[model samples]
Target: MTAAAPAPRTPRRRGRPSRTQTETGPATRDRILEAAREEFSERGYEKTSVRGIAKTAGVDSALVHHYFGTKEQVFEAAIEVAFAPALDAPAALEEGPLDGVGERLTRFILGIWENPATRTPLLAIVRSAVNNETAAAVFRRLVAAQLLRRIAGALDVPDGELRAELAAAQLVGIAMLRYVIKVEPLASADPEQIVRRVAPVVQAHLTGH
Candidate 1:
């Protein structure tokens, strides 16, 4: 009497997945950022909403909130993603002779615009900032704090902040014309040619020469 051979074991039902089990951290965050970039670029910050970004990302609105606390936070994260490469411009300055810093900075900034991959999101952020004051404030803060100040600090010269800002103005003007406004020959001209011509002016700004 085999003790009625223990009753057949029942299979356990799967419960709702935990956040860790369901969420794919980096990939989901990246998707949200990409969606935010597109939404903000197209609609501007005031009009872009968390629900809209979540819809674009194909994730729940809750997921977007979970990843980035607010719309402003999402926009900031998107800006960082779009500008991460350009943010390293200071490092380029660090690597080479001071004389070549302008060229390095120009080449790096323009390279971002030249590549469609980086340029599109950049265009979006720029357009949003231009159209919306709140967005502009955020963009200004990031540019000033992250890129401009770092570059100025690295220069270690009197009025370095002014010089860095001047150089940024030159580059941003060029970007607006070439990419956003799509102004004539400048828009279509060879990137190297643009660099050669513009780098010297940037050098003057940086070196006061």
Candidate 2:
């Protein structure tokens, strides 16, 4: 007689998916960042938590930790995203005559605030940074290390770092009043009008000639 039919094939067993392996790299990171931005915007840094972000992102809290490490790191990343345009300010400043650098920088910074897309996230970051010391530290580091240092380093002057900080202070003050505090004339004035008024002061700080 012919050999008995081959034993019935055992059903293949499927293993549980890995939390880390399933969602690795940029896609997962971006998703977490979007969720972080939303949470930070709605709840502010003081109230926002990793668990809350994870819930918003539909991922386990551990997964959020795996990607970003801490809420501070997540906020920094979100700030980077919101201020991406300003991060490029050094390049924009370098592109033009030194005399015009201030105008270019002013226009670029104000442009970011003028656009609703960039403005909304920026408001979140500024608001949180103002209220939370941890958030403020992150913001200060990014501004000092990324944006200000680059501009300062490019300058052909002594005390470049100080000059850069001074310039940044001017711009930051304007942003706070116009966008955050909603100061009357500044809040309502046209963006170009503000740029025209402020650019010279920034230029003096930067060039100092």
Candidate 3:
């Protein structure tokens, strides 16, 4: 024949999609948390529902429950997400001398509150904690489970458990005043000054003297 039949076009093979892709596992979790955060911020604990967050996250309502168990658990996770960034500080001291650990830790904690990326979520939890005992308990549990427990273990000091709790209280107090409450001077002061002044107090608390 004069014209040969054109070779049949090959269909492109598609790559297998990941089960734990970013839109899944951690990313899905984050999306749920962020949606939960917005819902909670606008509606508070009593009004916010898992279904609302699921709709907002564009996932099945059951998927939110699968990852978070309940609305309370989702709230807890969202609260924990607010503090997860600061939890990295103890690791900074894990491999080094504890002498200046307070300064680094203080800087890190304050930096998160100062950062717009992290501050809004933190404020949401702070507001919720102040008005709701359940929210407060969730906050306590998050600090104890996610942050203070690890910090106590990493620290080298007597009464590490008690010391870590106290140190947490001190830093948390500063966060409340400067960021949450918007107190003068403390709020307006430079970050370095705040860290310098507060670090020694946290250091003494951690070191027991």
Candidate 4:
């Protein structure tokens, strides 16, 4: 038989190959994070593990460690993603007159929880936070650093941080009652009505009026 022509060889890229198969792209990192969130949500922070997250993500535990370092780090990253939307609270505070800051913030925050698109992951983070101190620390650090501190800086008051925290307390209480705990009329009340009622309290916290 006559010899067939050989297939052409493909050239390899110049850079060193990644050490881990899962290190290829941001997609894998995001996959790990999503898996971590689901794991944390279902198991709570106390019970969730890097191995569990890796299994859920279809990656090696070493890969999860490579991406996030530890379960706490993974949990922090997951909370960061879940809380990303609400981090814009500072922008809402600065968007308009300081006098109306409370209502604007209240409306903006509640709007996020009301939207089904955002609520699911947020619920996961909130549940994990309420049940676990470690998870709570992660949530608090991000909120305090990225959300509350920014809002406080906008006000320039000596007690700005405290006020920001108070506003957060008011908004968080509403979220707990209406969304997490699902208590009574507050849960079923019109969004507009809740906005009207709660905004004033939030406003008083932020502006001291």
Candidate 5:
């Protein structure tokens, strides 16, 4: 008599909750980006293509374009990722008194380079950036826009951006000579020695005293 047996409760559909696009989108994007980095690193920017990235990622070229759009954009994404740890250099300035900021930033940035794990990708990025203008542009954005500009912001001084650039020039020069080009002396010098010598110079730039 009651509610005509409540319509035999249709076999409650039961299965694992399906993954949503939002959940999977990042993984797909990250895979594509990782592929982009390897391609650009091995093949260089000119030779690396969206198709190549897609192939390496085991995705469709359309998906690569869909996520990053254009080869240049993919290169930019890869540059951003490769430089990610170094990009945190700005935060080192915030961790302590401004007076010692130079050393903090110097140690932090160089520490990233000293670690072989982090340095390998950066070396590949720099090599590619050297040979291609487009690659250079992407790398420049990492340096100027992402890294130095943020460092400049933390300085809170007149011409902070310029000062940051100057400091960056010194550190970057060291990285190039010691790490990238593997030049003598610098390449062979003690890490602590490089930090000690360079910190004061960088401090002078960041703080005019």
Candidate 6:
């Protein structure tokens, strides 16, 4: 029989196309983070492992380590994602009059928890803080570095660091007790009412009111 003609062979590109299965790194990272938040919130820090986070994200456990070195790192990143608005508010405040900084900050914090979008993560953080000292350190570092420090820097005053820490402690403590711990009255109280009552207290800490 006559030899059949060979099928055409297409030349390959100089380099291999990306081996990555994910189309977008940032989007995948965000999904991983969101999944981590949900898992951490639902399971609590001690029970939520890197493998669990990865499974929730539908990615390999190694990817979690690739993106975020450790469980602590993942938790920190998740916290930052959860609190981005509040963390960024101080910089936003700088663009406007500083007179209403306290009110704005109070509203921002309450708004985060009142909204289901942020409430889940915030609850996770509170649960972690109450259950684990290491988790609390992670929470404190994120808040102090991202929110408190910047706010303190915005206002020139003595003991700004202390004021910032105190303000954060009050807000976080209230959130933990009322929301996470389900403290009576505070837990049932309307968020707006709480804001009105607590904002002034936080304002005093921030601005010496």
Write the residue-wise lDDT of candidate 4 on 1-209 in tens digits: 99999998766444323365645689988899989888877888888888889899988787787778868898999889988999888887788888999888989999999998899888988888899898899988999999999999987777999999999998998899999999998889999999988888988898889
Q: Write the per-residue lDDT of candidate 5 for residues 1-209, one digit (tens) a residue.
A: 55655566445223321334225678889998888888887888888888788899987676777677778888888888888898788888999998998899889989999999899889888888889998888788778888888998989999999999999888888999999889998899999998899899999999987
| Model 5 regions more than 4 Å off | 1-24
lDDT of 5 at 180: 83
Kindly report which residue stretches of model 2 are placed more than 4 angstroms away from their true locations once superposed.
1-25
Candidate 5 backbone overlaps, count: 0
Please report how far candidate 6 places residue 187 from its true position, in Å.
Answer: 1.9
**Each prediction's Cα lDDT score?**
0.88, 0.86, 0.81, 0.87, 0.84, 0.79
Instruction: List ranges where model 6 is wrong by over 4 Å.
Output: 1-24, 92-99
Best-fitting candidate, measured by lDDT? 1
TM-score of candidate 5 relative to the true fold? 0.85
Overall local distance difference test of candidate 4: 0.87
**Model 1, range 36-147, lDDT digits (tens) per residue?**
9889878878899999998999887877877788788899888888888788889888988888888989998998888889888888889888888877888999999999
The best candidate by TM-score is 4
Q: Candidates' TM-scores? A: 0.85, 0.87, 0.79, 0.88, 0.85, 0.79
Please identify which of the two predictions, 2 or 6, would achieve the higher TM-score against the true structure: 2
Candidate 3 per-residue C-alpha lDDT over 1-209 given as tens digits, one digit per residue, 9 for 90 to 100 = 59998999766334322333334667887888889989888777777888899899988787787788877889988877667887787786575678877777787788888899888888888888888888889988887877888888888567888998888789889999988788998889999989888999988887755
lDDT against true structure, model 5: 0.84
Q: Which ten residues in a row have the lowest lDDT in candidate 4?
A: 11-20
Can you rank all candidates by lDDT, best first? 1, 4, 2, 5, 3, 6
Candidate 3: C-alpha lDDT: 0.81
What's the lDDT for residue 209 in model 2? 55
TM-score of 3: 0.79
